[model samples]
Target: MNAPIRSDATPRLEDYPYRLSDNVRFADLDPNGHVNNAVYASYFETGRVTLMKDPSKGLVPDGLAWIMVRLDTHFRAELHWPGTIELGLGVVKFGRTSVTFDQVVFSQGRCVASAQAVTVLIDETTRKPVPLTDEVKANLKPWIRRGLDLYQRD
Candidate 1:
């Protein structure tokens, strides 16, 4: 387990310049008739992958991989099927070898679920934590948010 270094604050989705939209599938619903809680993580993944996987973005290198270390999710509201949702993600904190992402799921402009995840970059072959290079930082610079902690709960 890696130690988390709390920054001055977390950032919001709107604070970032980019986001991804995905739809809830009929099969995603649980017996309770709403999107299962488990699906929220996948939605978060979609947004993160979209940003990180693009070589043009330079967020992640070709031979490097990111692994999730921790995730804190708050299920504020339920999401129904037959609907579209937007996932917005931003950098909460940038560590020596890890980046914490704050993300929210919105349905019809209403926040349904939000999460904060800590991910570490590792060398694909060695599978060891690697420091974020200057190039990676340059790519991620556009996504960093400095103030207004979205993860703070009432």
Candidate 2:
């Protein structure tokens, strides 16, 4: 099971250890003149994929792959095109076979959306869930969200 999202607290970009910048494309705008709501998922994906897929991160093993199993999203504000946006991600919990992340999208220093995403590590050939290795857990320690009691809970 995944941890519940703590939406009562305000999100700060610095609290997330992993962050990246992306531009809002013209095509992302909806008929209402704001960025389409669905586009926020891709921004969150960029943050996770960039960190996990990098060889130096050592988060993924050679024969294993990470697949998203759940994403609980909260849309907080409207976003317009012709601007840049910031994405933030932090590891919130580590399950026996899955990892959960707290991700946020910020535009002009204000949070536009936030989500709690769960991804499972699976064997490529068998397509079965695999238990997380100690090494992978250690590698993710640096990316935990600050000011959380994750160590004691998980």
For every model in order, what is the number of clashing pairs?
0, 0
Worst 10 residues of 2 by lDDT: 1-10
lDDT of 2 at 16: 96
Residue ranges of candidate 2 with Cα displaced over 4 Å: 1-5
Q: Clashes in model 1: which pairs?
A: none
State the lDDT at 22 in candidate 2: 95
Give lDDT tens digits, candidate 1, residues 1-154: 1224343233344765558789999999999999999999899889888888887897878788899999898888899999999888877666789887777888888778878888999999999999977788678867765453423422
**Can you give the lDDT of residue 101 in candidate 1?**
78
**Alpha-carbon RMSD to native, per candidate:** 5.4, 1.6
Give the alpha-carbon lDDT of every model. Answer: 0.78, 0.91
